[model samples]
Target: MDQTNDTAETLTPQTVRHSILWRVIFYFATASIALSIVVSAALVVWNYEQQTEAFRERLEDIRVGYSESLGSSLWFYDEIQIQSQVKGIMNLEAISYVRVTDNLNINIEVGTRPHHSDIETLPIEFNGKPIGVLEIAFDRDAVIAKASRAAISTMIAQLVSLLLLASMLGVVVHTLINRRISEMAAQVNDRLSSNQYSPLAISTGKDKDEIDLLIQAFNALSEQMIDQLEQKTQAQQQLKTINLELEDRVKERTHNLQKTVDELNQTLAELHATQGKLIEAEKLSSLGGMVAGIAHEINTPLGLCITIHSYINDNYQVMKRAFDGGGMRKQDFVDFMGMMDESLGILDKNLQRAAHLIKSFKQVSEDQTGEHIRRFSLHDYLHEIMETLSPKFKQTQHKVEIDCSENLWMETFAGSISQVVTNLVMNSLVHAFEHTKEGLIRIQAAEEKGNIVIRYTDNGCGLSAEAKHKIFEPFYTTKRGQGGTGLGMHLVYNIVHQRLKGEIQVEEADQGAAFRMVIPKITEESNVQ
Candidate 1:
């Protein structure tokens, strides 16, 4: 008894409600009810239309049948007969009211008027002359009620037939499919509880159907799942062991890598510091070379001035002695005046030349040393750079030509430009024109598309492909041991790009290495310095 009670308790409301048999019945019943409602509605509407049309035809028939009789009665003043015909029309179920009226004072109405009805009026004429009119009102409610009754009967019959069919289908489905599915589910539950996977053994009928196929497929899937689960379990164990070893190895490797990274970072920082010092040293070295060149240049003019001064002093002494002894002839005095004029003229010219050289040296040296942004004539600045570097080329037959518009002006770091131009000239004299006697260097500047374009070219032994490629790399010198610091072109590249905020490229040239640069006429506001 307790076991039976337990069984009943196990079959909970959820299970009973979700039974396959009941579910199928509910679905079929719902579909049947919906279908009956739609069909019944259509039938009711059709019947109402048919009935309404028939009643209209009946009204016409009654009017036709009674028209001649009523007309004759009206002609003979037979009021009682007209009254009788209207009363008969009221007896028909669809007719709610009837009225007859004549032109000769015969008027009769029968039956009470309904609230909702359709009224039809017939004109009565005798021999093509209007006599009276017959009116009939149809009861809309009565027509609807008749159609509904007929539809209800048909719908009831159809519902009974559909429900019976639904019941039969539900039974067939339960016997064929639901029972086997329930057994399969029970077997699955049993297997789960036992922790043992096996093939499902639900009985199939004599001929195999979808149920048999489903059982076979489930058995095959169960076998595959079991094999996969076993393999997964073994793999998990192996992975656990491997993961421990991998974790230790990762820890060791991470420590070693971090130490190496620290060393590299230290090395890189030192390298950067060294590189900065080298660059500063390179700049200072270039300035020192310029100073040496300018010193040599000033000596020429100063030496000439010294010789002229000595010559003028001797002439002055002779004149003084002639005047003191009273032996100074007029011709001697005139010749002395002429010598004095010529000597003084030579002294004054030499002094001016020395002064001019000094001024050019001062400006170029200041520009090379100080980072000052100034507006200057591009052509004149290039010439000043060449003049300062003239002594370097004095012994050689190399010459630099400047081709720039005098009106082209720039507002930029003139010091960086001076450094770049000086470096390029020195590089040409040292490397480009090393073997050539008469080397020509051309510096061209022009305003193009709102930018100052400078093209520096030298007609010497042009750079090889490899040299050209690495020309601007710091510490990469073609003349490695012969006083080549390798930073000349690198400095030019950095100045043009960094300080001047411009772009420089090695252009294809026929006879020399050509460097083309495009710098903004006015530096960008952010890079004004």
Candidate 2:
């Protein structure tokens, strides 16, 4: 008896409800309840809108019919008639209260207005003049009660119908599927536990429904399982062979990967060495061009000096001959002295010009070769560099303008600065003015917030998007074969980024290429290195 009681307690309502048939019925009932609630809410809203519309129509009727009578009563000062007319309006549909107010300060209110009533007011006019106002308050609770009763009836009917349908559906599902499923479950459990593979058997008619198909599938699966059991030993051997082959392949691949990594490392070291050599070659190439330009510039002045020397020598021979022959006079000596003065002055001027050109060339060459820090005016250095580079521009119609403040001075490594400017100027001359005549290159410098901002621009053919992107890359040049080494701008980039520790960027321009560089007034040696 105690065991029976414990068994009954275990099959409690909660456990019993977990059955599939019960769950299907419960879900249907919940859906029916939710749908009923939604329908009821919609029905209530529709009824309220209709009721409110009817209430508005009746209010309009009261306004048109009662305004004139109420106005006549107030104009005649008839208190009894005003009360009678207001009571008449209150008797209309849904109107709970009426109030009449006249110009004479007579206010008459009648009927009881609930807290939730809607009120409307109308002006009372007689003979085209306003006499008083009529207010009507309508009761909404009675209408709401009617709509609620109708909605409740509808919800009850739907809930009953849905529950009946849900019960029938649950019974059908249990009879058609649940009983056969239970039998199949028992057969599968028996086969799994006892290691006896066998087809499940359940009685079925000739209809070939879902249960018949499920039985066929189960029988086929049982035959496949038996075949798998027979091949289990062979499958284990095959798996071992596959794993060994995979291990060998992995070892071979790992060895090859290591070899490839070593090769890559060696290649990278070689590339760095080659790049350093190329950079040195590029610097030397720029220095060689500067030397050639200076030589060409110095030749003209030296040639003039030679010519002047010969002319003075010839004149000295003439004067010495006249003195030695005893034919020299005071006027003749004065004439010879004046001629010597003029010739010597011309010789001295040419010599001084040649000396100045050589001095500027030497200074630029020294800065280009090594790093040297010296306080110098930016304006003077630009003119000096331009003087040395004048040979390249002097032959062309192109002009170079420098716009640096004379007071701006820097005490940093001038070599890098000189290299960067020289490269940029050369780059513009070579690439920027390819097809244009009278091109203008402008270099502007200013000191802002302890940094030197330099803007280099040219009024010539601008750089294409591709060229601008790879301009600083080594061995990248538009004029590949026309004496372009393709390392000028690359060297410039290295000098700015690695030597000066500055930033350079390409900017937009109207008719040409524009580049902006911002260099710090003082740079740390560690940062530069």
Candidate 3:
């Protein structure tokens, strides 16, 4: 039982052939051998029939011999003689024995009740007419006796022939079908042994027979497996590449964002630093211009003082020595006192000039730093600021004109207002004065619609349409690098709008530019909610 179990368990593909291949080869070969055996047996039986017919013809000849015998022919009643005559005529050697029979029951035979052991009738004809029946028993007993022996020998030969044919058939069948299987097996084994499976080239047979069908199926299976494996591998590789690319792109975008943030921060710092520099620059520029103007204003007065002092000194010394000598009379004394009065008058006149200079300087200084917001004369503020900016106006031949309503009470930032005025005047003198030799700056302050409207316009170099549009944005300037900070108008805009709490506007003039500040008068407090 265990051995049976082991035999059953031992069957595997490696150990045995595929059932389909085996079944096809088995059925094909079985059909071929079975058909051959059937045809051979049919031929043997057909030959046996022909041999049996030959035996009947020989029996007919024996019957004809019996009929033609002289004694047996007409009214022959001697049975023994008839039989002897029949035997004498057919005196051929292979006859084992002979017998005769009459129409009556009287018959005699040399053999016995069963001489031949197998007897049968043969037709007897005379002149094409059935006369009687002739029973010629060919010596089947002796034939059987010999045939049994021959049959045994023939069977042995046939068995040998069948064995030889079967051996050859089995060899041919195995070579045709089984050999193909072995070849396919080798291919399968080779595919397994070698590691190269991708785009595996599976081999197949040209014939579409049973064995070739199996190989075709196996080749197809192998090719399919290779295709699926390659597709899966390519998908995995593509997935890996996509993931790597996504990671790289994310990192690159993050780095770029960080860099952008750093750049923006740096730009803010630069803007703040630039603002500081601009403030200091405007201050220093204003101070230098103020010094130049003050010095110019003082020059004439100081020159006059120096001349008066020298005149008094010269006259006082000469008159003092003459009066001390006493060679002069009372009239000489009167003349001396008169000269002293003239010298004192000259000193007094020069002293008045110096006093006027000091007063104007004081007023301008006070206006520059004044923080108090009050109702002051618009005309007075314009004159003081313009006179303080005289040196710059002198540098560029710009004439500043003041047109005032003579009484406009506008409450606003005074220091910033002065600064705005100073910047505007300088902008005209410096930036707008391309035609400086013929430049004219007009400042007009009037009460219009319950508001104080101040228009500062210049006729020197007109602003282009494009330049007028962005004049107030910081760092936007038409002048490229000639000390044009572009912050002047921006500062003016901020002060006019926020510090003074007023509306300011600008427009392109035919010759230069015009700036307007429309400030609400103190009286317009009721107009605001």
Candidate 4:
């Protein structure tokens, strides 16, 4: 029972609030309209009855008076006569109707327009049986006019009273309910504001109404929410402690990470230094070997020069000794001159060879000057590189063929091109001639695709796949321990990419490796230096 009461109480606010006033309006408005209609109909009927009764009473009086005196009988007439009669009746302020009837059931009302939808036939007791039936149609318009006036007055009064009463009652109910609810809610809010997690103790007592049930359920829900909020608060406090610990851990780890990064940077610097040293050492070793061979090769020319000088000195000494010893002769003098002439020729040839060697070396290592812009024959440039590297080629059965070209370039960086060509040729000699002999090198240049492509191809051993991949990496060399400087190809890559601002690539062929370099053509604006 309590549960059912509680359930009903809980639902009352939703159900009763809507049903009450609408229900009142439904009952009151419907009853009022119906009562007014019924009252109007009854009043109309009563007025009609009174009019008929009064007329019948007057007829009775007239009959008695006629019996006592002397008068004729009365009868209805045609429409004109009935109108005259009705006008007289209306002047007398009596609502009446006249009708003309015969012995048959036919009835003709004595009026221009008769609006009565219902007409009753009754026996006239004048002579006993009905001689002729006369139905006095009631004047309903007048009665309805009075009734409608009464209804309007009643409607206005009812509407005003309903409005005032409903407002007053609604105010009283709403104020009482709101005051009680507000008081209880304020207590709950006070508890909530103080601790924010306090339990609600909304007292519902025993008379559990709708508000009581609502407060009970809300208090339960609020208590549950308060419990969850308390748990969340405790969890947040614990999380704050964990967050502080995590901050310390993060700081510690960040310091360690920073230390590791610093150490890695230092180690990288040292490694770069070591690599630079190793590359320099390898270059120096290759240079030393080349220098020794060049020295030995130049020794021949120097020896020739020395021999020429020595022979001339010896001849002079011999002439002096012979002349002092009284052995001077014209034939001997001619022979000595011939020998001197031969020595001169020999000295000139050897000295020229040594000078050529020196010149080639200087060209290979000379730094580019000024803006590094110049113009020269592409054929000559290619030929010069071939001449410079010809020594290494001479050691083997390999030979490079150059296609002679006329003045071609209008602007270029000569030193950078030289380095690229030098590296390409050196790469070919070092890597391509692994296990073969009688190799061939071809240096070809042509105008292609708005640029010049200088392709240095070889018919020696082709590039291995691994060598092709690592060929451009700095300090990466296939001949890592085999006296390779490794900086040669790196320098070539840089000169082509960075110095000339062009591009160079390599491809291993069936019998050799090919290096293709593409550079922009010179314009007319470039100086022909």
lDDT of each: 0.84, 0.84, 0.66, 0.65
Give lDDT tens digits, candidate 3, residues 407-471. Answer: 65566555666778888887777677855687888998888887788899988777777667888
TM-score-better candidate, 2 vs 4: 2
Poorest 10 consecutive residues by lDDT, candidate 4 = 66-75
Among these predictions, the greatest TM-score belongs to 1
Any runs in candidate 3 off by more than 4 Å, and if so which? Answer: 1-248, 327-357, 366-375, 393-398, 473-484, 520-529
Clashing pairs in 3: 462-511, 462-512
Each model's TM-score? 0.65, 0.59, 0.47, 0.51
Q: Kindly list the per-residue Cα lDDT of model 1 for residues 1-529, writing each as its tens digit.
A: 5554455445544355578788889998998888988998999899888888988799778877988887787778778787787778777768888888888678888877554336688888777777998888887788888888988888899999998998899889988888777777677666665566688877657788988989888999999999999999999999999999999999999999999999999999999898888888999998898788888888888898888889878888988998999999999989988988888788888888778777878888888788777899988888877878888888988888889888889998788888888888888888888789999999988998989999999998888999879999989998889877887788888888888889998888898788999998888658755
Superior candidate under lDDT, 3 versus 4? 3
On the 0 to 100 scale, the lDDT of residue 262 in model 1 is 100
Error of 3 at 262 (Å): 2.8
lDDT of 4 by residue, 1-529 (tens): 4554454444433344554445555666666666666666666666566655765664454334422211112233244543444344334333355553445443545544355554433333334334444444445566556656765676666666666666676566555466456556566545544545454556665878787888778777878987888899999999999999999999999999999999999999999898778655644554454556566767889998997898899899998898899999988889998998988999999999888776765554452323356677777676665655666765798888876457566366776676566667667777777777877789877777777777778887777788778787787777878977677787677667765667888765666677788877763333332
The parts of candidate 1 lying over 4 Å away from their true place are 1-27, 56-93, 113-117, 121-134, 164-218, 237-281, 306-337, 355-387, 392-417, 424-486, 493-529
Clashes of each: 0, 0, 2, 1
Measured by TM-score, how close is model 3 to the native structure?
0.47
Per-residue lDDT of 228 in model 4: 89
Q: Candidate 4 clashing pairs?
A: 9-210
- Whose lDDT is higher: candidate 2's or candidate 3's? 2
Q: For model 4, what is the C-alpha lDDT against the true structure?
A: 0.65
